[model samples]
Target: MSVTRTIPYLTIPSTSLKRGFYIGFDTDTLTTTNELGTQTIDAMAHQHHTSFLFNANELYVNEDPENGGRPPRVNENGRWVPPVYRDGFLPQAPGRMFRWNNGRIEYAGSNYQWFGGQGLTYPNNETLQHYSSTTLFWCNEFTQFQMMEADATTIDIATSDFPYNRWYPLTFRYERTLSRVSASVEEQYLAGRDGAWIAQLGLQAYRHRRNRPTEGLAGNLATIVALVAFSCTDDDTLYNVLINNLAWRGQLRVYDAEHGRRPERGVVSNIYLDPENPNGSTYDALRHLEWTDGPIIY
Candidate 1:
């Protein structure tokens, strides 16, 4: 009989609890260290600080030219980057997701800047009110599935587990499910690549740099799938969303509904799953909770 090993997996937030398995293995030979050893560390240090080091998230941007544009800002093509450092602030404190949209300019020592109403030179308030606000889009099923479609390129399903087509996987995921209005915002710092972590982008919310803690102004709710690993695809040519943000999801659904009058509820009674767990309850629950239900029209 082939014995199926059942490893009791704990959620990310569970390691720090008083009564639970607090164990890990470091198989790195380093410069000169033991290859195998079971390490039991402290609750606060291991759970709150160190374990977060390896976790990663991506950030993508849409930059507008350094001149006249829409009020708040315009979302455009910059590319994706990942593994942001925890600022030890609100979102990271409570552990959630946050997205901040801003302007990209060749500024002093930094390429990106969050346009808060300062002067026309620096404290320009008019431009600030107009182009300083951030908009949040609900990540629905439409957006999640759309990540798989070939956007002018063929879909490459390399992992065969997580659904990512093109090199970039643009979906926000939460360790826990989020209610409709829950939100968090953070200023994106930099990405570590090559040898040095370069300053590429920064993020801001409805309010600009007033020293207000970005933590609570937007609640403690977490944000997920903020950015994906960016890989070079084809051209510098960009597509502008003139009117609607509805791209592939709506169009494809409409096409399928019209041509093929499919049944209302699809059937899968023969689907096999361990009766011990019964149904894809746990898995579906996580996906329904963490992943956005459909396509976000932003």
Candidate 2:
């Protein structure tokens, strides 16, 4: 059954949930193993408990009304504005929430996103066991996302069998439609949440990828293959109601390798493209020349 609640955002000050809410699996299909707690959590109710009592703190609206208020049109040119605070912020922000328990953060959820379907992006991981996950791109900043598989194995980018390197800014949530609410309502998650994720994943993935790469990929540059590799791994999980398990072969973005495109989105997915492949050289047509070493993973 579909559920609805009042939109939170008393202010950007991170208010607490006066009336604690419930977060649990709607069904018993996906793996609830990773994140029984962290945001972007997609999983079945652990041990037959369909929902968990949650009290969220640090919940605020970080999205901007002028920048992208979702649906972008009250009717062509009427301008549908989100309720702004005294300080000027919207209630539909992503990646800026903290899960509270007993007056402290039980989980901290954050993530990086691109407005249009673009570089180094992937789905949100549905579990809390894994940290530093992200998800795929949207047609515009107006569209919100949801986790497809709640419990997806974190992709071991280091493994030889796997195609890409697993780095920071992980994409774990699946790209999806606005099914939870009307597209007109925008990205609303009961009061302290948005869709399957509590919030867009934070800097854990960014810090890992930008600093010390666990997969040994120290200096990755942007590449076509790296787009969907960013994620919060569970190893990972999100969509398709029947546990719509997915492993993508290609992406839908505005880059064409044969046509020669450059990084338009603000992320880079690979260091050296392929650490082992010798054909990688960016200066030939690569956007960032500093990373013009290594071979293409594709």
lDDT of each: 0.19, 0.22
Q: Please provide, for model 1 over 213-298, each residue's C-alpha lDDT reduced to its tens digit, 9 standing for 90 to 100.
A: 21111111122111111100101100111112211221111111111101110100001111222222233432342233432211
Evaluated with lDDT, which candidate comes out highest?
A: 2
Mark the 10 consecutive residues where model 1 has the least summed lDDT: 229-238
**Per-model TM-score on C-alpha atoms:** 0.16, 0.16
Judge candidate 2 against the unseen true structure and give its global Cα lDDT, from 0 to 1: 0.22
The window of 10 residues in a row where model 2 has the poorest summed lDDT is 50-59
Q: Give candidate 1's root-mean-square deviation (CA, Å).
A: 23.8
